[model samples]
Target chain A: MKNQWIHIFSGTVKVKLTGKGIERFLNQLTKNGVSIWNVRKHGSEAVTFYVNLQDVKKLRIPARDSNCKIRFLERAGGPFFLSKLWTNSGFFIGACLFLGLIMLLSNMVWGIEIRGANPATEHHIRKELDKMGISVGKMQFSIDNVESVQRELTDKIGALTWIGVELKGTTYHFQVVEKSEPKKAEVIGPRHLIAKRKAAIVKIFVEKGEPVVKVNDYVLPGQLLVSGLYGNEDDMKTVAASGEILGETWYSTKVELPLKSTFQVFNGSEKRKYSLKIAGRTLPVWGFGDPDFKEYETEVNDHPIKFFKWELPLMVEKKTLREREEVTRIYSREEAVESAKELARKDIKNHLPENAIIKGEKILHQSIENDKVKLTTHFTIIEDIAVGQPISQGD
Target chain B: MAKKWGQYVRKWMTQKMDLPQDVMMDLPRITMIGQVHIYIENHRGLLAFSDGEVRLMIKHGQLLVKGKAFVIKTILPEEILLEGKIDQVIYIND
Candidate 1:
């Protein structure tokens, strides 16, 4: 039974023998060591039996000696199949070419996504990517890796502050951060320094103006902190007021913090499985067994094979199993309240000027409700609050 | 006279040593599966074969198998596999 395939693969022939003494011819064949089976007598002078295709040539001798005519009834097995394939060689070649084309297309870059860039910069980036051989329809292997791409892009585009490049399957994703243009210096004329916001003066230094208000004085918006006039009123001459005034400003912010939070974190034990997907059926090529971990996360990435612009039904799927554990953090009421105040201070600091100094923070209210801590905090920031106002002719 | 003496001595040796007659005496060994198939080992040659009967030359005689719808399942130099509905097996002394 095990050798059945071997028997068929070597080929077989059904032969019909016609002679006066067919049995003698069969016996002669057997004596010649030509293993024959399924011998059936046809009429009184004819017989039919199956023999190995290779031994057909040997039958000519006994066939001549016995004076019998041997006609091949049927030819089968591997050789016949190969000859049939040869008859349709064109179709076979076409199928092979189609498969090869599909394999080539599946490994090409189909799309390039440029994010966080304006139209002009995006066009520029696309040109650069083309120069690097990373454009659409190009083979992925010919292009550089993502890290090198990022480095090259950052180096080539002077206006870009930072750029991130990622190759996701057949698509390339680019994240670009462009450098902001610096502000030009403005020409100053005769002007007074006025408070842009209501604040209590903390410190004042006048470089080219008369100090009209002293430190610890409270001023409103549009009020003059330093006048452009110099000396007494009789000898007053107007000039640009150049000064730095540190004023104290206050901001109230509300923040909420949850006392309990639950999140999942990976423990770093990972197992990868690779499989070929043909028309929705998956055939695992590696990593046959499923992961034994009970609590885990599965990330499946499917790369669909393509032929030219059309996507083929075949795909390659990669599954990553990572062991994960759920972590629940519980914070005490005091800790929650403290974090809430800290959050509120950070919130106010973000809206303040770059050189602003946080003087103090006072919690106006604190309450715990529904497993959450809510806090209202007031922050005092000391920053430069003076803005130059041009002196009009009427003034 | 010489052949008879050799055969007698071979028969006596087979009985004394408890040896298989087919091995010691050049006799044909026939194995039958029910009435449908038969295997003949150590046969000299096939003399005649038909749908109703099969004849083979044995060491001392010709073995005949009378049956219906007889088909030779396999044929080798030293063995034959015959398939049919068998009625009788007879040996003709020459």
Candidate 2:
């Protein structure tokens, strides 16, 4: 196999060895490790075979020793092709020039596209980018300097939020996202932390300002938990009143669940169908007749083999649907109570904030009726009750 | 006495080691594939070449193959590959 590849690359010659001493001549050739293949005899005077072009020089010794005459019949492979290439020098030079021209053209930026920008922002960015050597007609490879230029563009143009630099086949695509006006912050001079909910204080740790209330204090919604003012007249100071105040908050939740429920069960059977959709027109390619099951769920999948960037009208869509039977189950009283408790917990969780800790829970009511149960639970949660109130300097 | 020792050693190698007889005794081992191609291993040299026959020198004899369109596909110091329409293969012991 290796010998064949060598013959193919460097070219091989089919030569006819004539005269009576051909066998001795072949023996000498093989002894010297000269590779030859595909030998065939045409009458007693001549035998034809293939030899490597490199080994043709070594054939002279054996030909003379064995009194045989060697003659070339055919030349093949890359060496032969190269020899032909040298004969047409003008065509070769022209071909190289044409290829070099194409390569030269491919490196120059042909078009510049600025997207997601207004005319004013576009003009601003284009000017900045052009000054950074990213304009049209610039060499595409010089865009390596685009990173620092990208930062410069963002800094020079305050309106740009996000900027991108891309070179796509001799075209510069500059994408930009403009910045929107920021909302103004409302700052007040003094502030106090007040109870947002009516609850008994569980814990309070003030990091700044003076504490006005302690733990276990029953406070109304508008009462202050921490005062922002400090010191005694003339040297008095006011901070933002930063503190975490956890209070015991209460909530009530109700839940109802039916004793009987229906669930789906597979019947161990399935059907498949294949179809093709072209330009909004669907042609059923396979599978026939209506579905066997009355209640079944269908899943559709369409895969279109794309060409270039366009979605050709032709596409293959496969739909697989499974049939299921509904079965009803009745729950016992104990089972119903367990499920009812679970339902009541989930319902209370929905009404509580994420940071609200449920410290205690009690079932306030439970009633059973026709195929249903209703339950109500009261929950005690330790949650932050601080609310900021902006006050005037005089207050 | 030396010839006897050589024969004894060849026998021991052939029986004990199970090596190819051609390797142990320096004898030509000819293998043929459906009379289309022939491989002669452990050969001395090629004697004659013709359109209808090939003659090769083996260790103790000359191997003569009479065939039509005879060709020496490959010839080596110790082996030769022949391809032809072979009708007969005769070992003329010398």
Candidate 3:
């Protein structure tokens, strides 16, 4: 009974009766099991009373010798407020508002979210959705064709193998599977470590295999550092190789340091902006302008809404604008030369083995380049630099 | 002529002969006793009351009332007996 949709129909009734005559009529109607009330006269000769269809059919005249007329108005549909057929304007607007509220409440989504992927992949997928104009605080995403979204995403990011999307209640969920990358096979064949650059052999360690060069030997780029083949001529064994042959390569480097320099440094002040997307067009809710940091740097961060495409959930990109300051200093020629040599030594030291000991160092040349002094250095080292241990399997 | 025909129809409908009563002897009675209002409904002795207090006796049960002056208006089978100025009513189980 509660689930049934009951339609109410109402119609006005006109009756001819005096004040006392109407009272007697209502009393008789009540006595006959016809439940009604609010009976009142609209004019001098007429009285109106509301009655249900069943009771209307059962109505009967009370007096036999009296002169009274009963006329039934046209049947009207809707509630009492809506059944008034006289006026052009009434409570229709309020009724429409009430019905609209019901529809809006039932259609709204309670939750919206992305699912079925790791944070990284999910972030990428969410970004793509933002590009396609999905987002929060907007109308619920009621896309009928989710396959198209999935297809667009897979086409954009090759790492995603498959994807799925669904709507439950008011929430939208995304399911994604990432494609796995294959591993490279190990190199079991014989291979040798050759010189990657033109440098003097400052240190050498020949373990397992024979060394082609000794310490202090000058070597060029592409020269073999570790020999895969061993023994003198006939006794050479064609064996699968293992073990490290550490070789210290030398580098002649020239470095320059200016007496005056200008560098940009960030002061770390930022302003935030918000944006929204609708129908594949992005609209900025906040104004676009330079950050209000005069001495500080500026950065722009943009974050895409997780469940909504056009809605920005957070700021992701930070474009930092750093202000540069000029600094000046004066140095003697000897100081500048020493500083240049120190810089060159430091750069050359990176390519040598950790245990290599610098035996001697000398400045090969010094010159002026641009606004800075350039000094070239030569370094000598002696150390055991072996990379691999001997691997032997008994037959 | 139309008014005369309507009068004849109304008289015929109202003058229908009453049928013999096929009343059910057993009827469920609900009596509500509260701090303020006391309601009593009896099926055999069709009676109901709501006021300050009411004392009633029906079948084997006895009810005691206490409060201001009370009134017992009408009593009929399938009809209600109303009491005014009733505060409370206590019923003793037989």
Number of the top TM-score candidate: 1
Please give the RMSD to the true structure for each candidate, in Å. Answer: 16.0, 25.9, 22.5
Residue clash pairs of candidate 1: none
* Candidate numbers, best DockQ first, in rank order: 1, 2, 3
Q: Write the per-residue lDDT of candidate 3 for residues B1-94, one digit (tens) a residue.
A: 9967875665555556442222222222544334333344552331222233334455546566656534333233322233344554556568
What TM-score, computed on C-alpha atoms, does each candidate reach?
Answer: 0.55, 0.41, 0.35
Q: Please compute DockQ, using alpha carbons, for every candidate against the native two-chain complex.
A: 0.42, 0.30, 0.01
Per-residue lDDT for A187-229 in model 3, tens only?
5555555665565665554444556777667666677667667
Ranking by TM-score: 1, 2, 3
* Residue-by-residue lDDT tens digits, candidate 1, A1-395: 12335758888899998887777787788888888888898888888888888999999988788778999999888898789789999999999998898789778998999999989999999998889888889976456557778999999998799998987767888888888745688779999999988899999988988778888999998899989987787877889998899999887888988999999999889898989999999999998787878788897877666665567798778788999989999999988887777788778878987889999988889889999998888888899989999888586
Cα error, residue A172 of model 2, in Å, equals: 22
The 10-residue segment of model 3 chain A with minimum total lDDT is A1-10
The CAPRI quality class of candidate 2 comes to acceptable
Q: Which stretches of model 1 miss by more than 4 angstroms?
A: A1-10, A77-92, A177-395, B66-70, B84-94
DockQ value for model 3: 0.01
Return the clash pairs for model 2, or none. none
Per-residue error for A134 in candidate 1, Å, reads 1.8
